[model samples]
Target: MVKQIRAFNQLKELALSQEILEDSRTKGVVTALYEALKSRDAEAIQKILAPDLEWWFHGPPSHQFLMRLLTGEQESDFRFVPHSISAFGPTVLAEGFDQSRSIAWVHAWTVTDGIITQVREYFNTSSP
Candidate 1:
């Protein structure tokens, strides 16, 4: 969690230092997270997620792990939705919708000498 906060702070500093530009589609992704969460739709989450994804929430990893590992619902009552978004470097912090609300997440973009090699997700636990 500290690492995530540090990364977010770094992003803020960088944004303050430069004229930041972002894609509208990325905003759509943020909205999509929200829509998905409101509906508790994993399919929606999958749609926004990159093919090679790695997600981590601030709380339990089970729901996400179950989605990836079991390929379906293990039990109901667990769900997440996305909220606002912020970009720092190659990282993205998307707030989640639901109960646990441990502050949603998604980290991506591997840089090599200043180019993105890969982008993926770091899913967060859902909350009410």
Candidate 2:
């Protein structure tokens, strides 16, 4: 019985280690995307994002800053600096507040095989 318990504990630790590795990979992909954005490298952003990327937004039309930024329609003065980032499986969550615009934003990004496939954007709102 002691041997069995030890084996179970070992398996649990392995599972947790795998989860941490996955989380790190997911976060790495999202962080790279943000780096690409910060550099305004459209080609790099395109490489990170899937060609058929899916996007959903909840906020005023004017607040669709990410999309505009991606499309080169956003004003140069605005910036999105995520204060918190967390990952669960294939989904990554990033939250930030922009004092200049008084906008609080959250982004739920789904990454697959190191490519960003989907994004749900919320601006000026609280996320549960």
lDDT of each: 0.50, 0.89
Model 2 residue runs over 4 Å out of place are 74-76, 125-128
**What's model 1's lDDT at 54?**
48
TM-score of 1: 0.41
For candidate 2, the per-residue lDDT at 112 reads 94
For candidate 1, lDDT tens digit of each residue in 1-128?
Answer: 99999999999988766635443334445555556655768677566555554433334555363244325545555444445566554444555444454545553433322322344545554543
Instruction: List model 2 lDDT by residue over 1-128, tens digit each.
Output: 99999999999999999999999999999988888888888898999999999999998887887988888775665677899999998999999998866789999999999999999999874322
RMSD of 1: 11.3
Candidate 1, residue 110: Cα displacement in angstroms equals: 9.1
Per-prediction TM-score to the true structure, in the order listed:
0.41, 0.91
